[model samples]
Target: MSFLSFSPCCVKGGILPGVPRGDYDTSTLKKVGGYHVNSSDGMIGDGKVALVIFADIFGLQVPNCQILADGFSDELKCHVFVPDYIPNPPPNSAFTQVAKTFPEEYANRPWYISLIEWIKTIFKAWKWIPTFLFQGNQIRLAQAAVDNLITEGYTTIMSIGYCRGATILEYLLSSSSNVIQCAVLCHPEPKPRLYNHINRPTIWNIPDHDTFFKSNEVDILKRIMGKKVKDQGLEFECFVHKDTVHGFANRPTLDHEATKIAFEKVNNDAIEFFKRHLLQ
Candidate 1:
């Protein structure tokens, strides 16, 4: 069972409000009705629409996701659920280290199995669990959350994710028939190898900072787009922020002047895209 069982009463009680405000390693993921699994809640208008903002590997500690959540809640007038899967005070170990620490015998274990083991070590050493195990589980939990929200009277559903979170959301979008009106990704991981399974009105933001956004990166995106990126099907916008790095826009620590300019333009575009695709 999910640690955070999607419950309408939880949303009504306003228990899940905005992302957790603390360091990931030191924070316990707030659970809606079970163990630790923190979440935030807000909406655009009067709570007619809903959005779920999933975060990258660093978990909700990335301030950009928080900024986006605030802006999205305002623009969409829908409750936003930003859940933290990474336990607090993240284990002092890096993902690569955690991945390597598995018993030599478990080296070939399934990715999910290895991830659970990692979470166990992390939770035992500290009060937190590594989000590595939540990789494939976030969307399923998110979908359940949406279903719960729908019972609370939300009609529209939208999802947005950055980096690895976006990659997972893509999988969720492709697999589920949930009423996800539209899905957007910013700096998401490209589909491994050639992905020929895209089927949604998607939009991507590519800034100049990410290494992959360089000339070669554009080629890769183009290759990925291969025929899927069209005016009507999917809109791929590469608005390079003259000079900026990854995690620029919503990341306060890295928010450069260029990031500000880029985000101003992209944020507006995102609102319009969601409005057109999700509400209209």
Candidate 2:
């Protein structure tokens, strides 16, 4: 079963407090070995470590995603690249307008129409058709970006994925010959099979109130991860943010103090995890 939650609330976009509300600075955007990268100079050491950010469905063009990418570069003092997996991503205005009306529009659909759509979905599923077939293309694009970074002399590569992007990262990690050294998954849509195959150190930032992973689901994942930790001595860390919801890390509900606290805490934890695994 797919772990992805196609909830309207999950897709509803908003900007977090303290984050800038526009595109990344022009100076930060440059070509690195034939790949566009948002780089941060003046790294503390001589290590050639870099972070690849696989953004959520909103894609790399979203201001919140860009802000988070820039924040990671600034915090880690390393080169960060947010590849344009969606070449012609929807603009912010369009996304925001849709997000605002999606719930009401969905509710207003005729019952027969909804039933027909459900039947079509079931038929597609029965035929083994992938719901997010476009993800295959995104994976290839992300791989190219990673390969480009390696060509530019990066020795170690760490990945940070949000939402749908997390599934892509998990696919890479589960592959038999991926070069990703470590990963940080924020509000991931982790498949059950991933727990058994992940070899590298991973930090999972799970929101306690996630619509996709309820308490029982989270317990099952914890048990699976716990077994892996015990049997393989893997460094699979899971941090469940109390009183938090999905998208809290990137687009936190700033009105809530707990969400704000969880956002900062998760960011700090991810930074520390990267330092321990990749920088040291």
Candidate 3:
């Protein structure tokens, strides 16, 4: 999913997606400048704040991410942008090949068929080498998207990343300062080491069994992000959603009760986190 690695967990997480709430409307959105824009034009506030969503590998195509973006815009009455920062997001067919063939998702398939599919998946991964190697391009494209927003008169810019997109956001925020005001990472890709620097207020919406992060790794992220920043008001805090999988927040498994509840809670928490760190 990321430029660094092909995450099987991310592939499996894309199998079954949950439905977005009926009230979260996104009927009029169209791609503009390589991104989808959601806005309310200051219906509730001054509309000076802009939120950027670095979506999962599915990017702009994922319904859950789109709905979540709409929910943020509708709730906050601000501008929200979902940028396609990377190219050739592995298709649903790829996820199907990887997930259905994997034992965790389907145990009833014939061994020979599974083996064939597994081999095919391996070949697919090798083909993805070019995609992962383009992280630099992804960052450049993402940076331009954020910079363009700032140029458009948005005073406060906040961002959230899901899955592989989180990996990119981590690098973006670590390398640049004073760009994003605050952040919420939903099911972020967990790294083994601390980032070079994290200067913005960030919250991690961690799932019980993260697709990318292990328990100890999540603890490590908590420790790294939990450190209090001088005068940032709200510091890094990781909210663990219990009894859920890695993509429970962004690519919900519609049948699971826990997934639904966690999705709502994560969205609400993110909205509140953004509000608390307003530049005004």
TM-score of 1: 0.60
Q: TM-score of each candidate? A: 0.60, 0.72, 0.77
User: What is the C-alpha local distance difference test score of each model?
Assistant: 0.54, 0.66, 0.66
Residue 15 Cα positional deviation in candidate 3, in Å, after optimal superposition:
8.8
Pairs of residues at least 3 apart in sequence or in different chains that clash in candidate 3:
3-132
User: Which lDDT tens digits does candidate 1 get at residues 94-196?
Assistant: 3433432111324566989777877867555543343544455665565555566577687877777766566666676666365666777766655545244
Off by over 4 Å in 1: 1-46, 61-64, 86-134, 176-178, 192-195, 211-217, 224-226, 229-240, 252-255
The candidate 3 region of ten consecutive residues with least summed lDDT is 1-10
For model 3, residues 25-115, the per-residue Cα lDDT tens digits are 2322232254444554454346667888887766665565666676677766777777766666665456554442111445566789878
The list of candidate 3 runs beyond 4 A from truth reads 1-32, 38-41, 100-114, 123-126, 192-196, 229-234
TM-score quality measure for candidate 2: 0.72
The total of clashing pairs for model 1 equals 28
Question: How much is the lDDT of residue 229 in candidate 2?
Answer: 89
